[model samples]
Target: MPGTALIVIDMLNTYDHKDAEALVTSVRKALPGIRTLIGRARASDSPVIYVNDNFGQWRSHHGELLQAALAGHHRDLVEPIVPDEDSLFIVKARHSIFFETPLAYLLGQLGIERLVLCGQVTEQCVLYSALDAHIRHFEVIVPPDGLAHIDPALADAALQMMQRNMAATVCATDDITLDATPPVAEPDAAAG
Candidate 1:
């Protein structure tokens, strides 16, 4: 097992409400799996990195975003789902986590070579992240039930595309196992 990181993308309150309202039906199905994945990642001591969309708040601090989300509309749902102090949070201004973000830099810092990704808007953020990870030569694993998109058809299509074209191993949370070892030694590259 090489050092791998668990990337939970955009599991924010704003998105979850839309997903729950059936505006993004696929997310309803993906939540349970993502939740399970989070649990397993914590148990394995693998870093859990929450890659959140900043929603265009350039000066927005992660703590402020979290506080607002907790105090805002979906307080209850968002609070519990939000990553605790144990996890790391990185805010992004766009779809790709690696774009202008510390995500790539962080992964490099941790010597991560594999990624276990789970989260919202499967066809968009999830797909983009996986593709980026694949292109970066990171081993990508997307558990089938761990991600969702606004459109069910598109979500499924994206998953299939990732598995077929990007060499992402697709499995349900129940069937997948976490690789606990630290990533194998490699040249230290800047994470970003």
Candidate 2:
């Protein structure tokens, strides 16, 4: 078990809208594992974060997007997994959550060691966040079933790149088990 933060990225309805109905199936596949991770995070008192794109909307907040998306019928595919009031939500203007957001600062404040990233568009926002996390030197893990992409081909490439180039430990969700013990990653060693 790692001193992990469950970082759910861009699992919003708007991004899923770009794909056909089949995307809902893909997203559905990831939800169970994500939900399990969330439960484990809560049990361990680990922070749960939702890092979402604001869709380049200059004045939009994460809650507003989540509310509007969940308010509609077509949002059935993703609404249930939306962040709750207790979860930390960061509205990002770019692909990388740490780019212009207070994600780094928040993680620092929480004393997080490893980051378990899961969410939508595995080739885009999730990939960028994983790379950024690797650069930040946070032990990054992306459970296979915890992520999805609009295009399967692109998703494969991104996963490979993250493993080979970015140094991410890409494992299947079933292979991981959460424990209450904190990770032994030398406290705050990744803050640089």
Candidate 3:
């Protein structure tokens, strides 16, 4: 049975960009849902993977990244949801978590065939990552309530594309079942 993983993307952000205020506001609103989902995933033993952008700091480590983000404007959004001791952290140089990162190998090693994606910039990183995951044949699930975006309209469009083009399951955090029960193998279906 393949396992399911909760992929939290680019949440360890230092809100210093031009649109930081708007993004931070959105993230603040989504924090509760993200926290709830993380708790459920932890309770169910489903892997919680934090896929964060390296922010062009090639020499920076996860610890440094965490510290930098926590010291930023929206520490509230990054602190409470910081990776737990058992959680896995992967640093990515690009929007897609699978791009030039060890995410795919790690997921493969853990036998993760399904992914629950959540976090910042719904129209960018989350969108690209979902597309990458789809092409790689992984089942993708994105909880709208668990995501935040710089632009609402673009985020909505991105969600629609993910749903229509990649067959991603766009749902609310409360509606998702985070049980760690092994996934029963099934036959291949059309690419999402």
Residue-level lDDT of model 1, residues 83-180, one tens digit each, is 87889999988887788898888888887888998887778888988899999999999887887767778888999999999999988889767756
Find the candidate with the highest lDDT and give its number: 3
List candidate 2 segments past 4 Å from native: 15-17, 20-22, 179-192
User: Candidates sorted by lDDT, descending order?
Assistant: 3, 1, 2
lDDT of 2 at 69: 63
lDDT of each: 0.79, 0.78, 0.91
- TM, every model: 0.86, 0.84, 0.92
On residues 1-192, what C-alpha lDDT tens digit does candidate 3 reach at each position?
A: 458899998999999989998898899888998999899999999999999987789999999999999998878878889999989999998889999998898887777899999998899999999999999999999999999999999999999999999999999998888758465456468653
TM-score of 3: 0.92
The TM-score that candidate 1 achieves is 0.86
Better of 1 and 3 by TM-score: 3
Per TM-score, the best of the predicted structures is: 3
Query: Residue 156 of model 3: what lDDT?
Result: 98
